[model samples]
Target: MKSHYKFLGTFLGLLVFNSFTLASFSAWIDPYNVINSRTLPKFNQLKPQSNDDARRFKAINVTRIKPKTIVLGTSRADIGIDPEHPVLSAHAPAYNLSIPAGDMYEAMRYFQHALVNQPDLKQVVLGIDLVAFEHREDVGKLDPEQAARLETTSYVQHLPSLVFSTDTLTSSFSTLTANLKGEPVREYYLSNGRLIRFNPPEMPIEAVFGLHLKSAYFESWYKDFQLSQQQMDAFRTIVETCEQQGIDLKVFISPAHVTQWEALRTSGLWSTFEDWKREVVNITPVWDFSGYNSITTEPLTEEMHNYLESSHYVKEVGDLVLNRVFRHELRTVPNDFGTRITTANVDAHLAKIRADRSKWVRRNADVVQLVEQWSRE
Candidate 1:
């Protein structure tokens, strides 16, 4: 009887040990979605953080909550365009899937994932960044492991989130800490999936231009850039996929502020810019909005209300682009707002751009000085 009691005691001890082991693993691995199980009061609302890395957190969830229309691009599209805007929502339920500094490869990856998870997606509003097309090696080049992780099917890809992954746990903890302190959580996406500006500066046009002068980021925009074959292949795939799936695709270049144009001109990249427009026209017609135009020249009057900086434009310009593209509220496309580029007329269009750019360069001495400084550097 003592031997029997000893065996029973050992068995009970083992059972208790097993249970504890499993519980500890579960808390660490979090496979049952316990981390986000309880809603934090402050983080209930979708707040898009400005960091590009924050995109990974949103990418998987976007597939599950797929909207009919997806807006894809870099930061310009992230903060500039609102999918929930009335004009976009009127056409279809829309979501902005743009990422900060997102490239063509990332866009394709995200959209492809969305298509796989939600095949009913009907429209793709792609904001084609001109810089994305420069150089073959730079386009779509991700480490093999990272690429594999990014391309995993949505069903399995997001499973890690159900558990206590570092990214998810950190974000949750951060939100909790912020909530406890009554501080704003630095979030990156709205519930509607549009990027929110945490705090936009209210400055005159001169201050805005001065900000650009301090950063030489625009220099690369003008130097030794060329459209890549790989980029073209990726772009063609997106176009072909949209066509095959009966998805309405609207592609446009983002509206760069005039100072950006001046930089390009001063650096002798204007001709290259025209060449890019011509090449893009061959692949598919695009509404070119980058150069000398009323909207772009708005800074001259200190009344260019739609721009935040040389590279960033406000949502109002996005609205104008949408209106021009869809004709939702306007009978005619707004003048100098956007011009559709076609292969048939691209040469003529490019010539006119040259003339306009030269005329502007001659008149704007201050902008010329800024451009010359950038060029010299």
Candidate 2:
């Protein structure tokens, strides 16, 4: 009996030592800065972790910073919109909360999280993705617990990473060793929530075309999925919540490249897209930037410079979007690039888009081959 008691005591001692060893490992990795840092690591030094996990981890930090202005969208805004831009910061200290594949439901949760932390919040700029407004039949394939986690999670809940979580141990070791060797870290996203994607020095036009052809966005747009009522309801709630909270809200449709615009028209979703714009404007005034304009137009023959691909425009275009919407000044935007959409003129504006696209198609007949080739694949 005495020997057995002594053995039990030794076993408990080993368990306690092992627990501390794990905790120490967790702190060593601290990739998200969730455990040991008072503020996030230097924005440039921070790399992208699992973006979904990164977004969840970053949500806690953003609330702590409590910036008065927030930009919410998918990866388009993630890479495109800069919170530090003078125009955006002029209104309020801004933070970009955009995430990859982030939908309205996810965005709304983040916005609400911000509201809880920022009592003095002033403005919100939402870059709406038409795809985000579509209902997902299979939402939880990746990170199946994301919805519940985001809604109810607090920073404290994630602190188990500092001790017992095996994920923390693995990630920490990887991040530490990678940093030492100057390897390209998966943590390409900064603490500010901007995703600086690593693009090759020279991406040829054919590669760009291949990327768009293979992208899920291309297939989804081709399917001509209509916006669901549930998505609209969530969007309306976000708008109304901002209004009630006295936050200045600005919503904008991102400018797609000519190839993408052509897809929308060819898929017969242009009318549906127009309807979405009209509905959005009716909810509140919005800056309409979709459709074929000087901004969307690209020479079919030459390698396009302004766009990263068919859907993702570069930072220059992002600046133009902010300038047009906030400054009401067309810095790089052609006079026809955007309009202040309202209920009265939305119908006429959409009519103009159809007419303009018709003319655009005539001018760029070469696009038919590109489209046909993409459709076949």
Candidate 3:
């Protein structure tokens, strides 16, 4: 009996030690940036796993910073918009709460989280994504993990999944191994809640654009794409919430390369895209940047100087976006780069876009042909 008691005691001790060990490992590696206890170089600072886990990391960040101003959208804004930009100072202490592949629902939840933390939230730069506005019936369900993190006040409630799961352990190992191997840093999450993504230096911009052009994500993105009522409702709520909260808001549509516009037309979603713009204008006056302009029509360069791909632009363009919307550095921004559209002028603005599209389509036959080929694939 004494020996049996001794064995049980030993087993319990080992079990407790093992649990502690696992949790410690998870926290140290911080695979998802949940327990950011120790972020040392060659160990865990740059998080490649983070792009997919953006919702959780971003949710945690808003809780920590409680920023008064924020930019909201998908990876477009995540990669481009600067929280530290001078134009956003009208509403001080801005945070870029944008996440990769984020839909309107996810964006609203994060915005709500920000509001919960900072009730006196001042100003906002809400970048709208046409792709995110589409509701895919195939992926109708919210991710359970992201849903739980957004639901809970105390993130500790979700620590078991983050700190004790086997998958997390795998991630921890992967992160450590990546550091040990000295892998190229693809992305880094800043303390100010902005995310920085790096394209491979060896790869030319055309290759990057081709990768995006051939990307299955974009191929599937416009599949049966229609404007989602739920997403539109969420967008409306975000705009209304700002009005009700006495928060100043600026809205802008993110710009895409001409190839993407041709692809949208090829997908037979051009009418729907135009309708989406009208719907957004109805909700609030917005800066329309997703059109054929000198900026968006920038030829594919040797490096990612202007646009990252057909969809995402670099931070320099984002700065130009801020300057245009916030009415700063007007000399730097071309006149046609961004147009402010309201109920009164939306029709004229869109008509002008159609005219411009005609000219752009004529000028870029090769790009149009490329988009056509990619769409057929």
On TM-score, the candidate that comes out on top is 3
Q: What digit string (tens of lDDT, one per residue) describes model 2 on residues 1-377? A: 99999999999999999988877766655665555443233321344443537566657666446678888988788878888777777656688888677778778877887887676889888998787777776532336455545554355665664347776677666666656666555336555666666455466775665567546655754575867777777788889999998898889888877787666666667667777887788788888888888878877434566677777777778888888888746555678877888898888888888888889879788885676567657
lDDT per residue, candidate 3, 171-268, as tens digits? 88888888888878788666566778877888887777767866734557877777898899889989999999998888899987877787788888
What lDDT is obtained when candidate 3 is compared to the true structure? 0.81
Encode model 1's per-residue lDDT on 1-377: one tens digit a residue.
Answer: 99999999999999888756644443343222222233335533322222435365446555556578889888888878888766667446687878676667778877887677568888788998766666755566676754654565554555544333455445445544454566543434555566655333456666556556445355444456666777777788888899899989999999978887776666567777777787778889988888787788664445557776677788878888888877666654457678788988888877787788778768777777865765565
- The C-alpha stretches of model 3 lying farther than 4 A from their native spots are 89-93, 138-144, 191-193, 200-204, 214-218
Better of 2 and 3 by lDDT: 3
Task: Order the candidates by lDDT, highest first.
Answer: 3, 2, 1
- Alpha carbon lDDT of each predicted model: 0.67, 0.71, 0.81
Error (Å) of candidate 3 at residue 131 is 1.6
Candidate 2, lDDT over the whole model? 0.71
- Quote each prediction's TM-score: 0.79, 0.84, 0.88
Better of 1 and 3 by lDDT: 3
For candidate 2, the per-residue lDDT at 105 reads: 76
**TM value for model 2:** 0.84
